[model samples]
Target: MTDFLRRKLIQAAGSAAALGPFAIGSVSAQQKGDIVIAASQPITGIFAFAGTAMNNGLNDFVLWKNANGGVAGRKLRYVSEDSGFKLDQGVAIFKKLMASEKPSFFYGDSTQWAKAVAQDAVAAGTIMTSSTSLASSMADPTGMPQHFVPGPIYGSMHEILMEYIAKTWSKSDKPKIAYVYADTEFGRDGIPAGKARAEKLGLPIVTEIVTKQAGIDVAPEVAKLRRARPDIVIFQGYILAPMPEFVRQMREAGLQSQVMGTAWGLDKPAYDALGAMGESLAGVSPYRYGHETDSTMINAMRDFGAKNRPDMKNISPFYISSWLSGMVFAEVADRCIKANKPLTLPNMKAALESMKEWDSGGIFGTLVDLSKHQAPVGRIYRYEPKTKTMEPASSWLKV
Candidate 1:
């Protein structure tokens, strides 16, 4: 890390440590004492990288908002639980948060957990959104009402990747595609979507590679993809697993296949691992690191990093995503507070459902069109290791 980046990370860590356990003033003292948002993440196990990023973003946003006088003049409180990437533990933690505090909102770590929380959130009438981009099923038009996905669903990203390849590699015959995916539901979810789109584009999936979360070796898989000579290798795995290894090995083996990643597996850890070797590894992401478009929000993020998390240089898409979540929650709560609605789960859901083309200010450009309960669209970013940066590969895609 550069000297500037190192100093920034230290600041981020200090800011994170200063954020204590969440609490609020007496409900009787104020109609809206504190806005409690419950976050359940896998901070200990396989998805530690993403979980850490999500939590750090959540805490950082809360601190940033608090420093600015908080959301709608109400302080934000959060109960973040570590689920250890276990499904059973996830359910237990969700129950604890619901039973103890009855939080106004739920923020989930991964797609599976997002689905697990959907029914209860709806039954309780609490508005919820996820950092997970894979739960298109939960965000399905016909399925859940109180749930929102702020990023591109994996299925949509896969479609975009295929189109990019088709338009970019128009002349290649037998454009072989390789698949390297984790065995978990979140990782495997991208495969069918990718395959269906690949078939439509007439591209052949020549090599299929699956690895256990416990075992993340991609050398064998990379060798297979190399042998197949695929024009592109699509990676779908945990952030902590085979992705970085795959990228490094693919480069070591002299494989020229372009690397495309599904949503969950895309982040800074992937880039930091492969370094310059990760240049050709492109993935669909919700936010671009070097975005020149929203300077105001970008600057706010920079200030936050400089003040609190200097170590977390090159902010991940999850940072913007979590920041947006906090911003949206605050805005909706503010609307309810202004309308004299009670500050409770039901009231919050009412406010969120009534939310139209809500702008997240400079935090997010996508309109929070509640008709879809999803971000208007998401952007794709490609990592350019040569510059140690990530740049937009396309405009916001609405698929």
Candidate 2:
């Protein structure tokens, strides 16, 4: 954090000590210092908006964490490469960084990168990894033991939405749900699991719509959806391009079906681009929005952006996701250091898993548990265009 932000925080909290557990501490360095957190971030390409924000969030967190006592007396040092959101490029960056930096924690760009580097990370044995992905497959402790998700898996997100639909449906017949996703790995990842969850709840999957990454016509897709007339439609594997058009066209077709999305889709840009129709979009979110007051951590994030990134608007969900990853990294390293254990993969993995009812100081409204490699709590939120915020539509749910 900048000096101005630190001074402002202290003043806001009344005293240095009044800032509580997350308050800044003496900048004195320990003998064994500089815990490295490296990343192959997608700062370019399709996910640039999210990637740029995520990188900024992590960088700011490192600064803030160092100012706040440096995690067991060791200051954080962050290094990153812009992977351009390409899998091969990301993997190569991971290799180069691992060899050069020997970081204790590494954040990946995508599920492909996470999977590509998992075995190598395990072989390194000195690092644990995390990413923006909530792919259910990444949650396996045995298969991807050294990797952890910052939130619930995508399947769990779909199930959470289904649960909400089931509980709120007032008709005699079960509500019809449709899954509209892209053909990318991320787009197809959760469909099977989501279908299973819906079947388990006795709800019907009326239709499943698939789209390509680009150059696809939505008229046919909308016509197909109009025919299905699903009571609810859940979108996956996209940031913005087609969703706003789909929502608009669907509305024009005189369909009143509610639209929903998962984590990445809930970012501010996606909602803001939807204009007046944004209010109709609702979905599951694992992290608190930066503007929300309940989380001290979130408030601090906003303060950092305000003092540092003056031109930046509201903090995006991707920013919170990466910020949470930094926190998790620090917590794991802190645990290992306090116990006099080496910051090896096994040690960090154990430290990560042992965190039951872990308080992220406010990122999560509910206490977090990473034992399953996933923080299985999420809340339903609908965008309120009037306020330009995603207001909570339901209480927190753990699946």
- Measured on C-alpha atoms, candidate 2 has an lDDT of 0.83
Regions more than 4 Å wrong, model 2: 1-31
Residue 52 Cα positional deviation in candidate 1, in Å, after optimal superposition: 3.1
Q: Could you tally the backbone clashes for each prediction?
A: 9, 0
Q: Give Cα distance to truth, residue 249, candidate 2, Å.
A: 2.1
Error of 1 at 105 (Å): 1.2
Candidate 1 per-residue lDDT over residues 216-310, each given as its tens digit: 56666778877888878887766645666676777788877777786545666676665645355577765545345574766787888887787
lDDT of 2 by residue, 110-155 (tens): 8889889876776655678999888888888777778899888888
Q: List the candidate 1 regions with Cα displacement exceeding 4 Å.
A: 1-31, 126-133, 171-174, 216-220, 244-254, 276-279, 290-293, 343-356, 362-370
The candidate scoring highest on lDDT is 2
